[model samples]
Target chain A: MFRQSLAVTLINLKSIPQRPGMSIATIISVALVVGVLLGFSAMANGFRATVQGTGSQDVAIFLRSGAQAELNSGLSRDEVRLIEEAPGLARDSGGEAIASAELYVIVDGTKRSSGTDANIPLRGVGEDAALLRQNFELVEGRMFAPGSNDLVVGRSVQREFSGFEMGEEIRLGNNNWQIVGVFSTGGTVFDSEIWADLGVIQNLYNRGSGVQTVRARLENPDAIERVRAYAENEPRLNLDVQAEQAYYASQAGATSDLIMYLGWPLSIAMAIGAFAGAWNTLYSSVDRRTREIATLRAIGFSGFPAFVGTMAEALMLSAIGGLVGAAAVYLLFNGVSASTLGGSFTQIVFSFAVTPSAIIAGIVMALVIGFLGGLVPAIRAARVPILAVHAD
Target chain B: MTEDLRQDTLYQLDHVSKSYTRGKERVDIFTDLTMQIGRGEFIAIMGPSGSGKTTILNLLGGIDRPSAGEIAFKGQRIDNLGQGKLATWRAHNVGFIFQFYNLMPTLTAIENVELPLLLLKMSGKERRRRAETALDIVGIADRAGHKPRQLSGGQQQRVAIARAIVADPAVLMCDEPTGDLDRESANSVLETLQLLNTELGKTIVMVTHDPAAASFAKKELHLDKGRFVEREALA
Candidate 1:
């Protein structure tokens, strides 16, 4: 039975190229479905990686009680002073608190790929901000001196935007800022920001001694609960506090979920169309070979082998389609940089990542389509009348 | 008086009945039909259209079961066999040829001939050798590489004959084997069937509308209204 099944399956597959019109059409349709699905999935993955990779667990962020993002937070200097006295903060070598009072604002920048305008975050940080970051590297030139109009840009911003190379001066939002240094934060969202001294930003914008949010190094990863408890008790310092890692992960959810929302519906719609094409292809394949299948059955070949043969043909075509789609996306989009609005409404620059899991997901979808498409027709092939062999 | 037809009978149909439901109407094809076919006999079934000539061929070949009656082959009941067992029985006991020369259009002649051997557990080399030998016996070994469409009707029917005999089946069931062929092609196919029946001792039950085709068989049974109206021996 196994040998005859294999033989029948081999014959069915060998005949696929002879009826290339419908078979190729089915394969191309499945390919389009997988390509579209994986494209969006890879986009979501890349964006998730950038957002989630931003901060470390040992660093905690302080935002206003009702603020969900830094841009929505407002922290007075008096409240900042009270929070700085909280017991769980780590201290530097000089016993100074390892914290940064940050000012967040958005400025316009042109994308290098499309020359279209996008919102870029201009974050003003205190002296200890760089110390609180994990693996903070000044890749080129020097950090901006305090109270200077010099600006240091992230490597991603420099790579994706124009005129941000070292020593180059550029205008952003009605101010001329000298690009002094380029920095990297290991492909995190921080790599998409432009940074300057907090004091300079406050003074130039005529803003009072107020900050949007604060970053403080915790004594340990577990110190965040103490900070959250302290802020809950102090009415004047009442604020939302979270470990920086959790904060960025929270920031990643909305955008990634939105991407999945768009991807699933579109992919499903395409899948339905592909399923119809595959059904038509396999149905006609069985129809065209009805007499031959009957002859096989009449000659003592069981119906099981015929059923298996038809299913094998369906699955093989869809498998090939899936592989073609995956290879196309892998070559065309993997590691290709793109940017989209993150939870903060600023463009987070990232590169597409065609992960193995995404390819597996695409292939599984292809197989499901193949299986559903092949089912009824394979049954038909199996139930083909043996009397057809004696048709006079 | 004639040695009790059952003595050498290969097929014994006792009180068989067959009916087909066409929409709301039930059309009775056969009623309490009893027949016996002796072993190693080349019998031609001749009848007009819709007279159940092909139906008898179907029932005898184990591809179709009588609605009521016992069909025995070699003294064992085959009418009650399930579809799977029926297929195994047909693979071991019967080979078939159709009016259309029902060869798989996409396969070469040898591949079509090798199809039946796939049901048996044999190595590929032996299967190919047997298929080749069958083609040689049918005088079409050189055309093994050609697909059905690439061959003439006579050649296709010859390939069909080769496929029928490739597995060394006990009986060959032919349904209008020469119905679609020209005079010369029909003569050639009839001669091949005769060769298989006489030389290989393969029992052949052939259905044909032509008397000339029936003349090639050792005996002719004329069916009318699903009954054997006349049985004639051909010299």
Candidate 2:
């Protein structure tokens, strides 16, 4: 049956070239609809990838429990020391626990000649921060000197926004930090930030109580439960313990949810337009082939079978268009960066991430459009009178 | 001769009146028309424009239900048959040869001939062989691979004839089968129709305005305002 249907589908496909306008119109409409679906899904996946890749599995982040975002969470110096000294933390080569006091601050800066003010995320980390994240690599110049007012801008920021060029000095609050190097964390959220010494940012911003959060590497990621229990039982200090990966995952919840909710309605609306285009194209096609359909009907083809043949033709055409649209999204939007407001009351620059999942979504959307649009016209074709058609 | 006509009735149209309504007006094309066609008989129905000549063909082919009265096919009353069943009935038992040949432009001559067989549960190879045999019978086997657009009018009409008989239907109905062809092409198409009637012992009913085209039929029925006025049998 598929072979017979395929033969008829090929005939329909061959007719497309003769009616180039109608065929191309349908293809482009479906392609654009599929492209939009792919785009949104890529953005959501990219946001998740960026945040998740920046965190380490063996590392743990300490933030106030019940706090929605890290920006709203605060800890004292004693709490930071207690987390650093906690057992189950991974030991470095010198037998000292691997830990870092980190600070996050949002600053407004003009983007070179454009002079458009944009919020830039500045993350202040301890000396062991770079060593903890294995994926982070310095592509140009060198890492910031310890205890100095030096900073490394993300590679994406350096290329897209001005003033992150090597040797250029950018003002961080009241002090100036020279952009000595640029680093890339492969398209993560970290690629859009500037990294500095934690002490300087705390002092510059008058945040004297402690760093925003304390991060510690665990001896074994599986031992996170024991570490969390220890942090909760510590009588002398106030602390909250969570796997670094889990914290980043939490940060992505709001954005991922937003994308998922928006995707359905947007795709459905666009699909209506695409389906209409497909219906119009298929209706005209069925009309042009009235006599052919009549012949098929007269030859013992059931109306339902003829309808199935038309739908098969539609499905084949939509699948082709879907692949094209997905490919277009990959080539044009993948890794493209833009910023949106974050839960931390700051701008988060993220890139569009293309994955296997996004392509599947696009193809499914195209098939739906084809199915909905082709059904009615196919039935109409099947119901046409055979002898009436011959008379025409 | 009269005894031969009494063998068995293949088609019975009893008081089959077809009326079409347009907006607020009721237009009756044929009122109380009665006719019968015998098996293995070649018949031609001729009339002036608006005389419901084609409407009678449509009724006989199960393409449309009459406004009133009975249309019996093979002794079965088909006047009130549902659309779905009518479709099945047409597919298994009726062959239609349309004016202009109406061969699918994208299909080759043999493919068009094999179209009817696609509805059957036959293997592709078997369908192809059958299509080849049909084209051979029509003497157009050499042009089996040629698309309708690639063939001349006469060749296309022959291909249409091949399609009609490929299904081995009980009745072959042609509506002005050679109306769109030139004189030479029309003669060829008429010859093909005559061959199908005489050589294959197939029942054929043709509707045409051309007197020469009507001459090839074994019998001719002249219709005036949906009434059969004259019935002639060729000697």
TM-score of each: 0.94, 0.88
Off by over 4 Å in 2: A1-13, A91-97, A108-116, A135-142, A182-188, A230-238, A335-351, B1-4, B12-34, B66-89, B231-235
* A273 Cα displacement, candidate 2 (Å): 1.2
lDDT of 1 by residue, A292-381 (tens): 898899999999999999999999999999999999999999999999998888999998989999999999999999999999999999
- lDDT per residue (tens digit) for residues A204-231 in model 2: 8888857777788899897688788887
- Give the TM-score comparing model 1 with the true structure, all chains together: 0.94
Q: State how far residue B48 of model 2 sits from its true place (Å).
A: 1.8
Error of 1 at A346 (Å): 0.6
Best by TM-score: 1
Cα miss at B124, model 1 (Å)? 3.9
User: Candidate 2: what lDDT?
Assistant: 0.80
lDDT of 2 by residue, B1-235 (tens): 2233455788888888999999999999888877778888889888898888888888888887899999988889888888778866876778888887777788899988987887667888999998999898888999999999999988998899889888788899899998999998898888887888888878899999988888888777787866776657563
Worst 10 residues of 1 chain B by lDDT: B1-10
Task: Compute the DockQ of candidate 2.
Answer: 0.53
